[model samples]
Target: MREEIIVSGRNNPLIDPLLHVWHWEIPVYLFLGGLAAGLMFFAALYTIRNRENNYKVAVQIAPMFASIALILGLGALFLDLHHKLYFWRLYTTIRLASPMSWGAWILMIVTPISFIWSALHIKSIFPNWDWKFEVIEELLEFFTKYKKVLAWIMLISSAILGIYTGILLSAFNARPLWNTSIMGPLFLASGLSAGTAMVIWISKNHDERKRFAQLDLMIIGIELFLIIHMFMGFLASTQVQIDAANLFLGGEYTASFWIFVVILGMIVPAILEGLELKGYKIPIVIPAILVLFGSVMLRIIISYAGQASRWLY
Candidate 1:
């Protein structure tokens, strides 16, 4: 009777029955951060390679997206904190071993660079295009006029940020659903897919369209591999992990996991990328949009669902 009572409750259906566990805040952070980082990296890549008339636009837009992610990421962190005022305390000290500390430091470092980079490009909009306004451009030009170097640095940093987002979740060994090392790569891959899709949607011209199409295929392939590994963890892990998997695969959260994550986020993006590869462009755009939105929803569901299931157990 005690066991029966333990598994059944109203609050248990939405939150951890233990009351200490809330919604899946960490997972949500991972998702948004990955998407943001990925978008910034890829956009930087394209800007370097093409140097299209719109290179300035790419620089401007990518940072804006990244900044949005930073804002949302910080908000999520604040919400997760039981005492919001102590949020400043995170920056006051640093712990190398803590993934949260690492993430905070990374965000602190990357966001400013991105903003300055974007601001440098903004001078292009001025009619005179004077060299006086943006000092960073002068510095960037002095060390590396080649956009590719910039792209590579941005790519590497974004990849680190993307993987770090996953690492944050995996660091929590107590959460069976998040303990898998696979989460880091999986999050990085999804970040790429979602980020590339966002760029494709926002981009203009045949060159961008064609280039992003190729990128889409590559991203889809990576995302699929990550999904396979995620499921492999479920198959290979202990009972607690298996039980957690069931929550995503067959229980109350099944609709969200399957509908948003598996189908809309992954499969549709694959199909769309395939169509783009086959020279069908229009067919690909809609699915790209779906995948972007679905990616966001996927994070929300996993975060909430994972915690909710803990309550049941």
Candidate 2:
């Protein structure tokens, strides 16, 4: 009788395995955080540039949504915690080297500023609300008096918040896709794009809507470049990095990445916006909706695909 030999496939011990510890909460938190940051930043800008229109949706309504979005995003982050009760530990210390530490501190500062920004426009949003209450009147007066200063502070803080969303992921070097310096700016652009889309959707001013659409087109263009640059950097890196890049190129996430994020989210919106700019009378809401949806999908795809990347063979 002939001896039979059998071999079984096994994973390489030298390679580090991919981790799926992050889930839907992470992406949702990131998306909402970025969206809030963008909205607050633009609200501040609009307040400073066009104070005459204090009652406009861009100034009053957007800031209100910004505050709400930040609160909801924080709720998601809280839920994502394993020791939800110990969430206060993040605030107990400020580690200069820790991205999470930076994020905690940033969120702490940004949330109040956002609310203050919205509060400054309370009279415009709720004209019928009674200001007869002494404390309520005093609080509103204080915020209104220092509105300019608050706007400047909100702009800076919101920009940091948007950038921090990307930095949070980029700090995780174990994921090759997230380990890039460009991620911060890329995320900022995406957030701004989403923010502009939101403003376009809500603002009643035709000219303001047109301006935001143009701005979004520019942001989307920059994002496209950054994405290509990111992939180029990955391709030029080590084998592990190349493998990580493959996830977007021709691997598991290729179709969704290209279809949803690239084509539908970016290209199509840009085209529609461009046509609207050229007197084509395209429905601004359509492109705005697409951009917003794309922004969420972009965050989801990057969050999942980044986790899928590993150094192991």
Candidate 2 lDDT over residue span 113-167, tens digit each: 8877776677776888676779977987887888888888888999999999899
Lowest lDDT sum, 10 consecutive residues, model 1, at: 13-22
- Could you give candidate 1's per-residue lDDT for residues 34-152 as a string of tens digits? 88887777667666667645544455565677777767877887788888877888899999999989888888877765665555455555556655546755776654465566667
Best prediction by lDDT: 2
TM-score of each: 0.82, 0.91
lDDT score at residue 52, model 2, on the 0-100 scale: 38
Could you tell me how far off, in angstroms, the CA of residue 141 lies in candidate 2 after the best superposition? Answer: 1.4
**What is candidate 1's TM-score against the reference?**
0.82
Please, what is the whole-model Cα lDDT of each candidate in the order they appear?
0.71, 0.86
Where model 1 places Cα greater than 4 Å from the true spot, the runs are 1-28, 46-60, 124-153, 281-284, 309-313
lDDT of 1 at 240: 79
